[model samples]
Target: MTTSLGATATAASSASAEPGPSTPAPADELGVRAARIRSAELEEQIRTDPRRFRVSTGDRPTGRLHLGHYFGTLHNRVRLQDLGTELFVVIADYQVLTDRDVADDLPGHVEELVLDHLAAGVDPARSTIFTHSAIPALNQLLLPFLSLVSVSELGRNPTVKDEIAHSRQAAVSGLMFTYPAHQAADILFCKANLVPVGQDQLPHLELTRVIARRLNHRYGSGGVPVLPEPEALLSAAPLLLGTDGTKMSKSRGNAIALAASADETARLIRGAKTDSERHISYEPATRPEVSGLVLLTALCLGRDPRQVADDIGGAGAAALKAAATEAVNEYLAPLRARRAMYARDRGHVRQVLREGNERASAIAETTLNEVRAAMKTLY
Candidate 1:
């Protein structure tokens, strides 16, 4: 089933982390509007020459992607690809070990991740999709980049701090501490100039810029250039809190996976936390639970959360949940259908990955050769 994506998904961030929008706006007037405005402006810029814009976005492949991933990053990816931007989607299988102990399920995990990407309308023909471990040049690039960053600098990355707290890991892995460097390798290898991601990842993207500048300054001291400093293309995904009124993560058991069945989606939304208040309103500060449901409903239906709350005026929590469930099921219907088809065809998926690996290796090899030459190690 070849999914020809015409328009990208329009899931603006509810920006909800804990049953409320990330911004302090009234639940009715949250991140959705601002995100949409920004996104539209970015889309307008897509008509620029494609060669001038390259994008790199990837996932850890810890598990299959979810609705969060769709609205958060996947939607914009298609738009970028359509605009003729050189794109590379990396399956960061190695990064999963930062918190995970075993690779017992890594192979299946990587396959599932790629399946979700393709099913979501990531055209392998347009975008280079490859696994991180398969790109040996990226691994080689990491060591030299590490010398450019220090322990103190790495420790100051806010995103890393947040991830550590989220992971609840008492002992941090050395690899985890240096994750930004590995990520920089991915972006710099492709010389990607734009990366679409959620706001939470801004710091990591900033780190990539720092790495590129440092490398160009030191290695390209003679006004030569090796790496391109990348910029973040933040998405407009309105925050969609998990059913539990917290961050939507698989570990937290609150995330709604992209491939979740209609029935499963209904079940999860039905069980989502909501206040006992018999009437729904957009008061996020006091009624975070209800506000999150409203925000989620707005995202699925492409309307303002405040409007959703008004539509459900005087409706009880149960009614609110039912409405949200219906909206989500409707939004996910086509995606799930395509996903089912991809899941059944493992042979085809493997072939796609194999091709992606080769293409990505060639690209990375070209970059590595340049880096070696710059460092006077071209022997």
Candidate 2:
């Protein structure tokens, strides 16, 4: 493997071994670096005692999920679920309103998320999948969690800053600014102890931990903690860049949807930007556009990018594109077909979601009641 691939592999592993056992007392109780160190040690312990850790993750139902979604977190989700871990998958429908106002497409987007979950191997039987707007307590829990963090802190979150810039909005919505707190409610209501996320999201996860710590300290039963500070379980999947060689975005027309037709995958591959040279190699920095295709192939096939490039050695750009296209199509063929099957059974999908909503409401109410009792307001 190349140095880049090796480092990528190492970082991904470390990302999963995150979040320590210490219950932070306040927002400033633990520095980010120290907290991550403790998180790593705590994660190693949780692995041997997996039953103690409840995992949570979510997605905004703005559009269909793509390769990024599958490799980044979905693949590990299926594995964790199969292990009998208590997992909660939230369909963050309310979050989509951060940048959008059109409510007409929201229902379709919610339906698509359910279908995507099934196609991506997230079993409803093992993992509870529910819409964010379904659980009233989930939103109520957000009210108090919001008080634990500050506006400056929210603005400082790397992910939120990126979103603000990407959206290019002069005026940000209150809901958009406070979405991270809403996310805290999502994780803590389930008392999730582990959350599978990308490294880019670590800062936000740290914020969640801080919120849990603050709430428990202020309102716990005689200082006994009411919420769990969840840890981040990072995926090993290397990030895939868009065909444009900058970012994979639907608007840029460089992204490949998980449900894209095999022919469309092929077309995208053929049109992908690459070097003019005939030799195929993995050098993302020097040849990101070309290596981007190689990265896609390597990830889809679960092979090292260098090895993938060697396998396509001297095959020229067209040959390399052909190989990558074939690899992508082969990998997605089954998922797409299964997604289509699930889509056809929308009624069953709705039933799955309805059950999930019911389950989530029951769980959220219990958590909220505990919070209320802790605050002497249960009545």
Candidate 3:
């Protein structure tokens, strides 16, 4: 459960404080401010129709999760669970089949990934958790869903293009190509009404909505639609950069794990990239390095990244680095302890996932029956 400093640094950096605007507000302020705006929208949604809000989001267990995953989605997932909405967190282990290279270790990796989730505060007791491999009925829903979506539509998805460019695979597998359909199945199987997604993922969610609409139009008899049109609850999380001052990613070696030890965390932060400029400012365009430190400070302290940047204004980059390191360590100390406790009880983590899978499967079974009955596929 202990995240490596490498894994947690991105999250810490995301929490960094930023400098305020001289005339208006700093560029770094834009992300947090935008998030506030979006948060208000979410609050209104919850207030207006609490019963209509059910969130389903998942991660592909290809590797260990980084701080980006924590702040970007995991934290939000925890908050949504507390809001009394039905939450479904999936470990998309089967999605790993898209890359044949990692196919062999998928099962073990899924377990480790689950452990990471527990360490990061995804409570299985309150929220349902399941892996794609464990939910056969859900996977079965993929074929009919696929028929509803066109191949050209899948080919046109921006994410598919990005993945093709980034992936090592020379040719995209059928699973990789049809990932959106699988995603549709994931959402519809549980009839999830809300899906928390990043801006980049909006298209995928849109496709899910399209598929749901198509299925309902084609199959609806006298009763209601089998699937609900899932709405996208876009996240306003700031883009966190890696130690190299680039996008934080596991593949890039710039990411810090969520469960890293204190010593490792300190070392990673110490080695983080910063501008040569003596003074700290949150100018993302000009001073990305120093700005990164400022942003990290803001997120950790729950203050404006701009404010943090201004507080250390005129202070040398050395001072900013020191402040950033101290702020990150302070924030992560308690998390590290909690992660350690969870890590020690590995069996407990498995049990949580197993129990979650049972809960999720029960729901999946009921939904599948309804789906099959609607399609007249019931024997």
| TM-score for each predicted model, relative to the true structure | 0.87, 0.88, 0.87
- Output the worst ten-in-a-row residue range by lDDT, candidate 3: 1-10
Q: Is candidate 2 or candidate 3 better by TM-score?
A: 2
Candidate 3, residues 67-103, lDDT tens digits: the string is: 7677677777877776677889889888888776667
lDDT of 1: 0.79
- Best-first order by lDDT: 2, 1, 3
Instruction: Give me the displacement of residue 42 in model 3, in angstroms.
Output: 4.3
Q: Model 1 residue 310 lDDT? A: 86
Between candidates 1 and 2, the lDDT winner:
2
TM accuracy, model 1:
0.87
Q: Each model's number of backbone clashes?
A: 14, 5, 33
Residue-wise C-alpha lDDT for candidate 1, range 28-111, written one tens digit per residue: 244444544665566667775666788998888778788767766787687678778888999988887765543678889999
Q: What C-alpha lDDT, on a 0 to 100 scale, does residue 139 get in candidate 2?
A: 96
- In model 3, what is the error at residue 366, expressed in angstroms? 1.2
Best by lDDT: 2
lDDT of 2 by residue, 1-379 (tens): 2334334555434433334677544444344455557656755665677677788988888778888777666777876776668889999988877555434589888988889889988888888999989999999998888888999999998877877887756788888889789899999999999887665677889899999998888987766799988887754457678877877766677888898998888888888888788899887767888878887887777677778888888879988888888888998988998999998889999999999999999999999999988878866
